[model samples]
Target: MERIVLPGDVVWEREVFASGTWVKDGITYAKVPGMLRDEKFIPLEMAYRPKVGDNVVGIVVDERNAGYMVDLNLPYNGVIPTRKVRISLRLGGMVYGKIAFVDEVGNVDIGEVDKLPAGKLITVPASKVPRIIGKKSSMLNQIRDISGSSVFVGNNGYIWIGQKGNMQLVMKALDLIIRRAHTTGLTDQVAKYLDENR
Candidate 1:
């Protein structure tokens, strides 16, 4: 049966919670509002949680002798050590990398850092990132192909587009995907929309 679930609502009886959900007292609870269909829970909205090996988009917020502090759209900021980056870090510059470590309280250490060129930045609900990328990044590639704009999506919901001209169209496509993430054939729909609109 499909039903609406709110935060803290019991979604399952298990020790370990799913990626976007949480566990309390040996029971799983929905961390965000969404639908529970059959035995699966679909989160409609979710915040970014730092995890090792996740690729993220961040903005350089502060510089340090060791490295720099990056705002990763998380409650706690992330850091990139000097050795991982080649360019001179500047305040407000965009960076991309894989999270190398996450401390006990959500602090993250990012690795393989690379500077991203000037682009328009957009944010979406973190839970919708998977839908935006689609299977094997087919949706992302299609958007790029149709719009002819460079695009990068982070697990944290920050998106970078190489150009601003087509970003409006891209955002529209993203909105559709986010709203219909649970639906089938969304990739095909997005592809058609982008091709026709672009």
Candidate 2:
């Protein structure tokens, strides 16, 4: 029978006592750069992680004089350049942009996707497009007012939303609106429901 060796246990061989150095119970741990010892390594979701030339959906978190912070659903926050956003976006309007840069830090900045009336370059589902536009452009107007974006809906189900000032923020707001609109009457019902529920 052999005894299990533990950390700090001594081994005597050939009348020579070799002091046991402290070793981890199972395996030796290695340190990787930019990683914590106790931190578990979790891979970023490919759907949420931005790849080169991959289109992404994000929302504006903070608007600053220099630029805006975008919630790209990544490990790091994305930055929206002032140049990429339009100058007419009011405090609450919707804007859309294209991913132009992704840094090692996971920051993604995009160029504004302008050129409205050119037709549908960004195509959403036919059913969902109506939700984006809303009834008689009611939802569309709400998106425009809050995101500071100009939204155009084509009969072909093509939606174009441009930024007024900083397209990044407006685009972010629009993304929220579109996603929520899928739940049916989420916009109007939410406010009314809140008033009633509370």
Candidate 3:
């Protein structure tokens, strides 16, 4: 049975609380409406908010005197300072960078980026990245091996597929993973799909 909780609802003591949860005194409370699954609170819905150390795929939308303004696929644009950039990027160029910091006011700082080569870019929900990668990158490796494509999965949910063999199959597998991320036995399903199709 699933335990659905609303904001401010008191939870049992000693239960570990994850993000979107808080504890006051000896009791824990939900900070968002969600279901308790495997002792983790999975929110009903949420946005992809950038956090420090998150690798993201950003496009150079505009170049500023100080640096480049990157589109992080978020509400706010991220700034990649000139000093942090090792290579020059042109407008519309895509790069893989890490979020160095996010201020309290929600401004983001991007750093340590590498220019991506020409490839197909696919975007999925950031929350589904872990499932796509699977345990210790098992799923990712499977796709890479079967498709012969170099895959880069950003923490922000931007996936870059380089090289060309079985591109369609790769995209199909990724779509399946994203669409069914919440379902159980996903790894086995993906593996089976790949084997059968191959």
What are the models' TM-scores?
0.85, 0.32, 0.85
**Model 1 Cα lDDT, one tens digit per residue, 108-137:** 998988889899888888888988988899
**Candidate 2 lDDT by residue in tens digits, 1-198:** 223233333322223312222224443232211111122221111123454554444455677876776544456756667765654333222335567777876667766633333212344433344455667867666656654556665322335555353345444544655556434356685334333422
Q: Name the runs in model 2 displaced over 4 angstroms.
A: 1-47, 84-93, 113-198
Cα shift from native, residue 73, model 2 (Å):
2.2
lDDT of 3 at 158: 84
Write one digit per residue (lDDT tens) for candidate 3, span 1-198: 467788888655755557767887868888767677766677643467789998888778998888899888788789988876666898988888889989998788898888988888888888788788889999999999988888888877788888677888889999999788767789899989988987
Off by over 4 Å in 1: 1-3, 8-16, 20-29, 84-87
Q: What residue pairs are clashing in model 1?
A: none
Residues forming the 10-long window of minimal summed lDDT in candidate 1: 15-24
